[model samples]
Target: MRIGIRPARVVALLVLVIVIPLSVTSVAGRFMGDRVYLLNSTPCRVVVMEQHDGHEANPGETVLIKSGFVDRTPTMMVFSGSAFWFGGLHFTTDTLQVRDQADIAIPPSWLSSSIMGKELTYELTADGQLLVKGPTMQPSMPQPKGLPLKARATPDSKQCRRG
Candidate 1:
């Protein structure tokens, strides 16, 4: 058999093969990308706290926290004018204290790990507010002093309600 080489035919064949696949892939990717899919079904827990000093909080202000961990306990504290909100698994020896002047707010949606060893500790002012001090990761010093309140008083009070 005798074969003749044609540059034009070879080029056309290569273009057709490459372009067809590329076009198909691009279209498929676009369609698939728009369809939202859950990559994983693992559950996550989140806790949030907001605190203010003797100064009252303004309306329409909101605080949020997002957490993701395979096997870890989380704790949060919120302080309002002389109040505080605390949630999550905390050790008994862990101190639950806050500044007296600060207010606290912990949302009802806050969650703690159900694991047996998990413990949550919280301290609040008489108005049921959280008294948070220092950094969220590690707060070394106590917050400024305000009027002391009981954590039980305003267990479910919203942040806007702290007057």
Candidate 2:
């Protein structure tokens, strides 16, 4: 007796062997990609600093994150404190300033992180705690001066009044 293999059966078996393993690997890869493993990591606290009346004060804002394994970037929207203190015409206005940087750093506690063109420092302790320092406040820029416009009497207006 002689036996022969069908081409259609061989192709189907090849497809099954290749596609099933690929599908399984892809599913496993997705789960692995979702998880981030950092070296010797635990829960940590983050603090942001603020200034008031030439003195530093705690804004009481805190963020808890995993140490050595945070990935984040920030776009900042701030009010530009521009003011021109003149007599009577006190021109004080708040301008919206936004800065977008495509280059974002990884993780919130990855030692050094850069956000909104400002470099932030992160310190991790052995006791599973973290501290993050924000950028210093800069001085405000000089505001625009409001100038008085002198109005002149037009000769045409006087002639039109007669008509």
Candidate 3:
């Protein structure tokens, strides 16, 4: 005798198969993505040679994060996902400078470990150790600077990275 397959049962099974994994993935991503922040303390804008996976943003280029006017509302670059999470992103540390001020040189070790400060999604793992999560949306602010970065040759006398 052939077994009768109920439509409702098939739908339920399909929902369980699709919805469960999606919900789990979403929840895991929300808690597993480390937050990367770059707070610009100076009055002048801070420019970073940023490397991001999205070609629409910058690809592997520079971005100018507007300077913070007041301490209460500081301008910052809050990047997550492979952009700031992955420590091996070499193209990112290529440049860090303040307009009409000074350039900051990043050490190889720092670059390898990622200069951007991170808030662990889970305390148990290293920053960017798990990238099951990536940035879901691009915010209105922090758009990549349209103009190309100007060359700076002055002594990299300023320290830009701070905890």
Candidate 4:
């Protein structure tokens, strides 16, 4: 007769009961939000080139942070932008103005981690190129001084997806 259960069996059971559920829960959490943090490792100025969707203010602009990234320079930067999703990376996102910028414009996120609070660092070459630890996406620095204004509505949707 078995005392209770073998140690190996117990371990396996624990993994199935606890570890597996935890893993599944974590993975599923990604859908909770599309937040992200972008860091710049470039020497030159980084700038947002394009953004596709999720703008509540301007339908024409596509995103509010396109012109928001703070001096995406090589020296060092992090997104500080905010959005309906991602944090305006400690660096920037779309609108480097207002309160910096962030987004559902999902970026290359960290492992086992939800897209939320994901820190995606990038590097820029001397000639204006891009680099990163994994898949890359973010804004550049020194975006015009103030936020670009449009007559339609206003600089809304720091939450952007420049995809």
Q: Distance from true position, residue 143, model 2, in Å? A: 31
TM-score for candidate 3, residues paired by index = 0.25
Residues forming the 10-long window of minimal summed lDDT in candidate 1: 36-45
In order of appearance, the predictions have TM-scores of 0.20, 0.22, 0.25, 0.25
**CA error at residue 15 for candidate 3, angstroms:** 1.1
Candidate 4 lDDT by residue in tens digits, 100-160: 3321122323212333433333333222222333442334432233322121221233332
The residue-level lDDT of candidate 3 at 51 comes to 40
| Residue 102 CA displacement from its true place in model 4, Å | 16
Error of 2 at 102 (Å): 3.4
Candidate 3, residues 51-120, lDDT tens digits: the string is 4322112222222222111111122222232133212221223233333434433333222122432221
| Total backbone clashes of candidate 1, pairs 3 or more residues apart or in separate chains | 26
Candidate lDDT scores, in order, read: 0.32, 0.26, 0.29, 0.32
Best by lDDT: 1
Better of 3 and 4 by TM-score: 4
Please give the range of 10 consecutive residues that has the lowest summed lDDT in model 3: 120-129
Write model 1 residue lDDT over 1-163, tens digit each, in one string. Answer: 1344577678889889998888776555423321111111111111233232121222322221211211221343433344443333221212322334333333222212233222222333334443432223453444434323334325334433535
Superposed on all Cα atoms, the candidates' RMSDs to the truth, in angstroms, are 17.8, 23.4, 17.2, 16.4
Off by over 4 Å in 4: 1-5, 30-32, 39-41, 44-163
Q: How many residue pairs in model 2 have overlapping backbones?
A: 2
Give the top-scoring candidate (TM-score).
4
